[model samples]
Target: MRSRAIFLAGALVMVALLGGVTANSVAAATKTTVTWKLSSMTAGQNEWLSDLASTNSPGVKTWSKTGSCRFLPEGFKGFLSMGTGKSCTLTLKIAKSGKYPAKTATHTIIRAPSPATTTTVTWKISSLTAGQVKNLSDLAKTNSPGMKTWSKTGSCVLSPKSDPPKLTMGSTGSCTLTLEIAKTSKYSAKTSSKTMILALYGVGDTGPAGGTIFWVDMTRPEGSQYFEAACAGWSDRTCGFDLNEGSRDRLATWGCAGTPITGADGTAIGTGEQNTIDILNGCEDSALAKFADRLVLGGQSDWFVPSKDELSQVWVRREAISGMPGSDENYLSSSELSANLHIGMNVNCYSGCYIHIQKENNGYFRPIRSF
Candidate 1:
């Protein structure tokens, strides 16, 4: 009986010691649970937290938890890390500052005042010049009365075009740009606007025709209003010659039958009348020699008629064509005019060479070029 009692007491002591150890282990785990979340984030915001049940684990600057991520304010340069199965509330208060090197200043080139539903966007300088690039942030401030200035938080870029920069966008969308001057002081503080939509995109791979892109040097005017002539004045007769009083076809008494007329007309005529009677005898008369002369658009003097292949490119982008103003017709496609021509010229796309007609007796001339 004495031996049995001693054995029972030994067993009871062992059981008590084991129970105490288990309780202490559970208490240690409970003490490690994290409850705080992150807040007040500016540039490089950082925080550190202990892992559940880790007695002496230090905090990290940035770490991932399953599918979530953590960021630090710019000034706070430390981190808080957690391990698998660990849970922590991350409350963040982000500050608006333009300190991030990755972020960019933005300025937008919009077509109109309330560009809410505008798709065909055109942009021009009201206080600037064509081909001038400005930072998107600057542009936005210039254009809008109330909007937050862009922070150095995202990519912003500028793209200028010699012509009015055009873009297609959702009715309500925004774009960013970086702008610079390319013309004289006379061009400064000048205003320009787009007839279509526009937005700035960061540097990337793209097609030549993907965007309204141009390069400008503020020293002198690189683009001009030369391209924009009164639609009536753009006619062959108005551009290159005056008609003799009698016959339209018979070249006037000028000594050179085919020389383009440089002298101004003595009489004044309405723009509408000029377009109706313009004889295709000047630059348009010769498809090969003078087809590209006397271009007037976007203030450019070097404008020319697009070559056949170039015109074909325009044909493909017909969606972009804002046809001659005050006319019901679009520019003639090779297919559209072939059937209507009183005099048909050669049009062979395969051989890569063909003839085009510009006769005074038949059709009118509509000059065009790419932007």
Candidate 2:
């Protein structure tokens, strides 16, 4: 009976030992370990860590592993992932070196030992540089909370915006004005600008003056008659004036002569001025001379139709006075070529020739006044 009791006690002890061993084996099957091998990363560089693991016993079924990184410093980010083979990798990259001394981050690894059980391991990462810190500070300063702002550089200036500006052309006979743009602290300078031109003119010149200079002579002697004497049958015809008559004779025989007369300037002499005045005075408001008589230019009231010589001078300088040459229009002169014909000049004449149209023929009229 004592031997039987000893066998039973031994069997009970064996059973307890086996139970303890079975408990230890189950604990070992579910146990997992995770570890990180990196402590810091450099700025502007990539860091890779492949030493992370989620190890478990072969008895553990349906296990999964995952890794993640968070709370990284400014300008820094990290990635972590677990592969199908139960291995984990952490990758870190720095986009910019911002203004900061050092940055801190947390890396976490999760291991699922079973469908309903999980274990997590966490650690800290610290890495940053002075230059990166400075950069980050600058970015923050430019983009503050209250109102964000930025800076840029460039310049622009306009002198006359509403009206045309005037410039005096000195003795050099030319004038110029400029429009410019400049560079500011934030902008670069520009090389292109606008330019304006100012035409030149003489002091006593009249009419549309620019590009070239011209003058009209007002050297008529005092007390000269504005018209010739009354004559019949020559209303539309010349009063017998010749082209070669001298200025003195043309002036003395104003009522009877059709002469080519000239002034001291070589083109202002002729009897046409007197003839036009006489015709207009006789006919009152019906004559072309009335058009000249009514003209008031530059505050002068004594304008007259030009003589043949005067018209010639105007034609020669037409470009300077009007910015363009005279058209093919015929202009009347006060001189008479014959008893039935009145003298006229063609502005577009190539050889500066004279013409005789009927006294009543229509022509363009340009009045002149002495300055």
Candidate 3:
């Protein structure tokens, strides 16, 4: 009975020792608690965490080996995405004797600036760009907001070194005016204030007279009225009226009324007879002589019937008369001539003939007389 009791006591002691050992092992494992979180996800980095493990894990059975990853900090999980070739960091809050270690890894990605974009602006030809001429008139045509005023540097010559580049304006924003090249001259288009001419903006009353320096082009119904008689055939009495209505009228009136003085016998008035008839018929009929007997224009009595060269002068100097009264009609007259390529004549009239005034039309005349 004594031996049995002793053996039972020893067994009890052994059971107690084993239980304590098991308890110690469990406490050791639970003491090592770990807290982890992803810090950053750099560019080119994968959205998911590449590596995750408890720092306190032993080599034999690491946190990753168990596949029992714990929860991260409340707000950190949402910001952990990583792009390609980029990186993300993980922050660990480890207890000294707990389940995790304390450490952080940060990764950053690289980026570049975006490519440049192409932009364009409409710029008018200011001056003669290099080897070209600056043609304001031509440019104004066919362009929105036609070319406005030009700068002083703009040039008329085609070989460059003329005017600066410029643009016109209209209802729309800044716009470029198209250029029209002349068929005869190398000039892109006619430019220069030599001739005072301006565009007809809108219809208005026959503007104030004499003060206007420029001319406009307006076609009135009066032109077609006496077209036949005005376009006389053959005789110098009618002058060259067929070539063009306006031209015939101008030359006939100017040349006929502006012819040299003659004696009653139809002979040229040699040196000193008053030749008021020349001025009287200039650009109008005898009745409408504005400058007959030597009228004054620009303070001079030399204003005679423009010769053929003078007519061409009129063409080139068309601008000088722009914007003035009757300019629009004059331009229409030119258009009429251009359409037919007509050539009227201004001949010398020695024989006595009545200088007919364009019945209803008004004209300017300048007579010749020795002062």
Report the Cα RMSD per candidate. 21.5, 31.1, 26.6
Model 2: CA > 4 A from native: 1-204, 207-276, 283-286, 323-326
Candidate 3: regions farther than 4 A off? 1-293, 321-371
Error of 1 at 4 (Å): 13
lDDT of 2 by residue, 237-331 (tens): 22222334411111111222232222311224444456556655444433456655664433445556667776666566654334222457666
TM-score rank order? 2, 1, 3
lDDT by residue for model 3 (166-226), tens? 3222322222232322322212233332211122221111212211111123222222111
* lDDT assessment of candidate 3: 0.29
C-alpha lDDT of all candidate models, in order = 0.29, 0.38, 0.29
Preferred candidate (TM-score higher): 2 or 3:
2
The list of candidate 1 runs beyond 4 A from truth reads: 1-19, 26-34, 38-236, 239-303, 306-327, 332-371
**TM-score: model 2 vs. ground truth:** 0.30
Leading candidate by lDDT: 2
TM-score, model 1 to reference: 0.25
Query: For each candidate, what TM-score against the reference?
Result: 0.25, 0.30, 0.18
**lDDT, candidate 3, at 119:** 23
